[model samples]
Target: MSEQNASAAVNIDITRIMEMIPHRYPILLVDRILEFVPNERAVGLKNVTFNEPHFQGHFPRFPVMPGVLIVEAMAQTAAIMVVQTLGKEAEGKLVYFMTIDEARFRKPVVPGDSLHIHVQKTKQRGPVWKFKGEAMVGDTLCAEAEFSAMIMDN
Candidate 1:
């Protein structure tokens, strides 16, 4: 994708998202990319449900989405943006988390909640990129964090 095209709003479905990232099955937290602006930012959506594997062990009577998983969803959103910015050549590359700072969980995310993950690039050098992300359910802020990741050939 060119700079011109990158600037335009883009919607990525589950199939395309699968091609860009390696996460799958129960771990593929992001269900779709609602909007993507290459190097700038991306907004992804995850539809939480009771059928998720974690809910069985996380809490049987009162299921709640794990905080760590929420952060992972944010990271996944960032990774998708990174891959889109780098183009097809970087597809299937591995993005490993280097650091997670100032992470906070404000509200419990339950099943039926639509998690909107907003991630913006803060800094980038070589293959390492820093991002600030927020997980929101409608207008409610559920969680947020600042993190960095290194993208490398798989």
Candidate 2:
């Protein structure tokens, strides 16, 4: 971990997350970063709610958060890991999806559940970053995946 990252804040609120990445409103999935170990690992959080627009169409009878959105949450968490690690130098950069492997949605995520997104850095080279992420609600595993992304100036 870089010196700056080593001393990085562990708790990151939504306002701070918004400054890190270019996401807002309905599309911004992560609500807070619960744990950040700079370049090594990060745990992001999203409070699933019925008011979300996707739930309206995902299922009328039994609303469920889409699996694809879970993966997007993981991607965003990984991006924050990079941004937090590099600090201000990473401000104007964006992380783009390169690949997603071994993705699996084990259970449905519903409203009233707090989705815990845990991601760890598996590898990094230049602007490329690889990670393994898992989404969970309480003790149940909701999703898991291995993914890669590239950080580029926007």
- In order of appearance, the predictions have TM-scores of 0.94, 0.93
Q: Report the lDDT tens digits of candidate 1 across residue range 3-45.
A: 6546455679999999999999989999999988768999999
**Local distance difference test scores for all models:** 0.95, 0.93
Question: In candidate 2, what are the lDDT values of residues 4-119, reduced to their tens digit?
Answer: 55633467999999999998889899999988886889999999999999989999899999999999999999998899889999986999999999999999999999999999
- Residue 102 lDDT in model 2? 100
What's the C-alpha lDDT at position 86 in model 2? 96
Index of the highest-lDDT prediction:
1
Worst 10 residues of 1 by lDDT: 2-11
Error of 2 at 56 (Å): 0.9
Model 1 TM-score, 2 decimals: 0.94
Residue 84 miss distance in model 2 (angstroms): 0.2
